[model samples]
Target: MEKFDNVVLNSRAKYGQFYTDPNVGRLLVSRIETAAPNSVIDLGAGLGSLSMAASKKWKSASIVSVELDNLSYFSSLKGNHFHIYADALDYDLPNKIKNEYGEFDVALCNPPYTRPLWKPEYEKILEEAGLSETRGVPKDGRAELLFLAQNLRLTKNGGELGVIVPSGIITGERSLDIRKKLLDNYCVGSVVDLPRGVFSNTEAKAHILFLKKSSPYKKNIKLYEVKKEGGV
Candidate 1:
């Protein structure tokens, strides 16, 4: 992992590739309520920290990691895991994975946060994925939301998702629409406000958002706050 530390730091802004702390990964996985999921997937799995944590917790599960860079690190991972080198946002990904692995029982991600300009192609992708009505899709696209949507699409109907996202997606005005979509369309399990400086280079606030891929949104979602030194 040290060999790619410099690479991760250099490409942080470009790829939104902040690696997850192992403790945080464990915390996120702990929040997921699934008992013995058959399969687990981590999209945009930089260095596979989150996937690794899931693997530790669910020893019998098959782990799947999709990453666009740092292929060598994934190549070195052992155990019942399949690592794929592909863009998580590719529109055909859902179909391809469905044919190969079917919908996953658990999905985890710490997706890229870079905001690229919105394009018709992106709109088309979301529309085709049945997320056309999803709120808070910015005119200048947010990579996090796009990745979140894709994760949701990839998860089975009753699957659980644990994701790390910027706090802006939780409270910022620009993200209001997406927040509404989550509340209306999914069972939001909880949101944990992580301590500042969780990432090595960025002080940007972030949260662990847990959701179940079901409708008739469950209310009174739990909220938590964690100190840098401890778990929630």
Candidate 2:
């Protein structure tokens, strides 16, 4: 059997195989402080990698991790981890998210890198989808933008958000459009360029975002072009 079937749940068709390894997970958790989740939600939660790490680091934080694939929620890695098997776009976002966690203080995700798969799911939907379709729905679209918006809604004012997304979200021209949208609603507190090797086997580059929901921080936002520093 495949690794996910043996551990979590599997759909047979792979969306993408870039799971942030333990080391990188630690790095992300560390940067975000993973201090205490009044409640923490993870999108694209595969095998509980980041959720597991966050649990170990923030014993007091409530963590609600969600993954849509059949393989993840049913994985053997399911235990000791609170996994919600739901499509991110459709899931509810509450100010006080409760799970094994009594409440949540933060939310985050390592979203999907766009692939050819998106066209089929979206091209047809686009004809009828309204503002959400044009603007990109956090729970529905490629994990990055949707997750950002989702986090903003789920987080309390002044609460913290840390997510891993594509560096292009900040650098690419098209992605800059997404960046503009993010800036409109939330504050970009910090940016960590995940090293390329962190996603070596994969084709896309990633970035770590430390965001504050209410507004931008007073200090200059930190930026790093992490080329291969996130050890998977």
Candidate 3:
């Protein structure tokens, strides 16, 4: 990552910097079917790990990767993915969607696990993430919720969403509304349990949540428990 890319946004690496582990990235990409091929959207796409992996799986899959950091932005250029250099919260995402060859078929993101230090409230973090408005920086709201909302907005009908969020968030009281929101909007596919050491620099037990939006087309719910030890 470049020094400028390493520049902190809200006290964390710009572009929500958590490089997805190789094995996990591969697995996540593999989850997307190449048979039908769906458009892929990657938010906070650090180094384009997942983007590149998806491209490898579905050669025809059009990937729209979002990365604000300079280094990650450059990395995205190495692949066949369309790179967007902007904040996830502030970017005109629907425009990008309209401009894409097709509607987004999958929305993938590894959002910043923690809220910004400058303003500990949820609304503040969301505003900077570009997911929502800064309607008076409420003391509530975790970045996790905002990320989910943004993901929902980008994913099309019958599309899938793969998100890596801190485990505590899934069960936390503060995340209650977010959890409900997710269930109401999309069907929970699976929860892949990741240990604390999965992160290169941090100790966060993140859970990979697979979501598929359902209208009247898709029905039922599928859940998987993929548990593995250490790094693969």
Candidate 4:
């Protein structure tokens, strides 16, 4: 594996790539109470930490880790999890794997949060994948929101998903529509806010969202504020 410092200093920051801590990965995994998911996907599976952890827990499950970076994807090759070199946003893996793997039983992700310059094609991709339609974008075009939408679209009806996202998505006015969209589709399970330093080199405050795909959306969503007293 490349030096952590080098990975952070060279490409990750620009790409908004922050690898999940092993302990944090396990914590997120524990939130998934499903007995045995037949198929699992780790979107933006940086270094495959989450995927590796999931593979260990669900020994009989089929795990697929999708990472865009070649270096990270190559490093993941050492693990037992299957790694795919492609963008989770544009690459429609769920549709492709429908015949063999069927819909994903679970999707675990720590999606990129940076607002990259999105082209018109991105909206087209989202529309094609049933994530969103071609409409006026939000005031703050958050890539993280799009990532969440894409993952929700990929997951099977009744499957679960857990994703780490910035706290702003929960509180910010810009995220109101995004939150509404989520409320419309999934049964919001739990949102556990993590401590400041969970992602090692990044300073962004994050929260892990646990959601289940349900047709009739529930009126209530659970919120958890984890204190640093116990150490995240």
- The numbered model that scores best in TM-score is 1
Q: If both were scored by TM-score, which would come out higher, candidate 1 or candidate 3?
A: 1
- The candidate maximizing lDDT is 1
Number of colliding residue pairs in model 1: 4
- Order of candidate numbers by TM-score, starting with the best: 1, 4, 3, 2
Question: All candidates' lDDT scores?
Answer: 0.79, 0.59, 0.62, 0.73
Where does candidate 2 have its weakest 10-residue lDDT segment? 1-10
lDDT: worst 10-residue window of model 1: 1-10
Which of 3 and 4 is ahead in TM-score? 4
Candidate 2: tens digits of C-alpha lDDT, residues 1-232: 1221222233323555467766767777877753556567777776666787777777766667877776774243333456677765443434234333543467767765533224333433322221134343333345455556555555667777778877666676645555665665567778887665565355456678887766554457778654452333
Could you tell me the C-alpha RMSD of candidate 1 in Å? 4.8
Model 2 Cα shift for residue 70 (angstroms): 2.8
Per-prediction TM-score, please?
0.88, 0.72, 0.75, 0.83
Local distance difference test, candidate 2: 0.59
Q: What is the lDDT of candidate 1?
A: 0.79
Error of 3 at 1 (Å): 28
* lDDT, candidate 1, 1-232, per-residue tens: 1212243345645777677877788888888899999999999888778888888889899899998886437544567788888988887788888877889999999887776567666776666444565554556666777788888888999899999988877767766767776787788888999997777566667898999888845658888999777857
